[model samples]
Target: MDTFRKFALNIAVFISFFSGLNAQQTYFEGVYSEKKIIINNPLSADLFGTCIHRITINGEIYPFNISDNYLEVDLSLLSIRKGELFSMTIDHESGCVPIIYNKNDFKFKEGVKFISLKADGNKLSWQSQSEVLLSSLLLELKFRDKWVKIAEISSNGMGNQNYEYIVPFLLSGKNQFRISKSNTKQYYYFPVIDMTEQHYKIASNSVTKHINIIKNNKPAVTCYELKDLHGVIVKKGIDGTIDVSNLKNGFYKLYFDTKEEVIIKK
Candidate 1:
């Protein structure tokens, strides 16, 4: 994977497509000192097959270079000076889905190279280089328009590293994830990864042996915590279903995503 240099982008604008928002966020802010806008498609294809997209910055067409990933635009060529306010947008074919890594993308060090950030189920996997200055990292999620710290990641304290962590509790809809160094004057962030969404409905409240969850009429990945009548948590996990065959017949409170329900066990 290639590294996109000097960052923090207007990421909230790019995620509107995935969140199914009717009106997209327009990125109209002063340009960062960033020179290159790099994107990675993550699909294996021939160099010649690389897609060519258009970028309109301040209503002017800006040209960029393409590679195995997505595309990289050199802002320097556009004659846009630092601190100059600019509005940018990307245009592509209907079937093409090119994410904006430059949008809402920024980091701590200029020498650091962020390789990639990916989401699988409820776990987040990312890789980075030149992390010698970092001691520990804090993972933050965008909630209610504010960035909130949810987990602390221990850095390897070495350059060129890869790591992963499973989120304890996640929201049901689209979420943005950001990472920052702990207890530092600078709270820089890497490009935000759009976290997974787990929207599920109880297949049944009459718990016979297992509680099933489904999304769009099929099994769905979910984050849930189950508590007994006494308000003591008995089970919690990220899975598609809950098993409670051994528990004695009684009423239990089921907590999932953003909803709570009272379930009857037979």
Candidate 2:
């Protein structure tokens, strides 16, 4: 049996505290394969049976009946494409809410472990713990709204898992990286921190004060957000020094792009 396990479902619950009532919030977990997929409920049956659960993919509804706390889907008859995204929902008299059920989020194949990728300056580094040797992989950078292919790297089968590639062109502000084999659905995102700097300084903590901002010559438009210790954003402005004279006396986090700095108000 081709078993895929441990993936979580996006469960949305609508609860009314005053009435001591809650709408159905289905928690789906477990295995999905070519022959069949099992969506098991991690919550009580009361929340589930209270609403109607349906799996809709590509505009087709595949109805299922809950048996033994799971919705078993037999794909032998359904013409569902492998690696296609789908959505789930619960319909009730109170409201109809949609849930996230993407096919790509599941691991259908075995022996494919995840690797870690990092970006420092203009260089990209990737490391894997798996002994499986990867031959060739494609690298793409997110530029504006489009994906730009930066490199197609070929690896020699010498059992070396750590690799690094330097970017030839200049990358402005912040960007994302995608590394995978060409034409395959198996791709991974490398989380990289933004290297852009926001030249800002808090002048004073008095009732009336101004922040000083030094502008840099970068093409990308930068935005700044001032967040409290609880991570609540108090104020936001375009990539420059913002006035926080009206804010409470406490420590605040200054966020611009992927960078963060802590500031205090007396």
- Evaluate all candidate structures by whole-model CA lDDT and list the values in order: 0.60, 0.50
* Residue 236 C-alpha lDDT in model 2: 68
Per-model TM-score versus the true fold: 0.37, 0.30
- Number of the top candidate by TM-score? 1
Decoy 2 TM-score against native: 0.30
**Segments of candidate 2 deviating more than 4 angstroms:** 1-114, 129-135, 158-160, 197-266
Q: Tens digits of per-residue lDDT for model 1 on 86-194?
A: 6677544333456657654323332334457777666787887765544678787665455667778888754578888887655766656776667653454444444
In model 2, the Cα lDDT at residue 222 comes to: 40
Writing each residue's lDDT as its tens digit, candidate 2 over 63-166 gives 44422345556544345444332233433223433333444444433223347678777788886443233356778876534566767887532222687888
Q: How far is candidate 2 from the true structure (C-alpha RMSD, Å)?
A: 17.4
Candidate 2 residue 47 Cα shift, in angstroms, is 75
- Model 1 clash number: 9
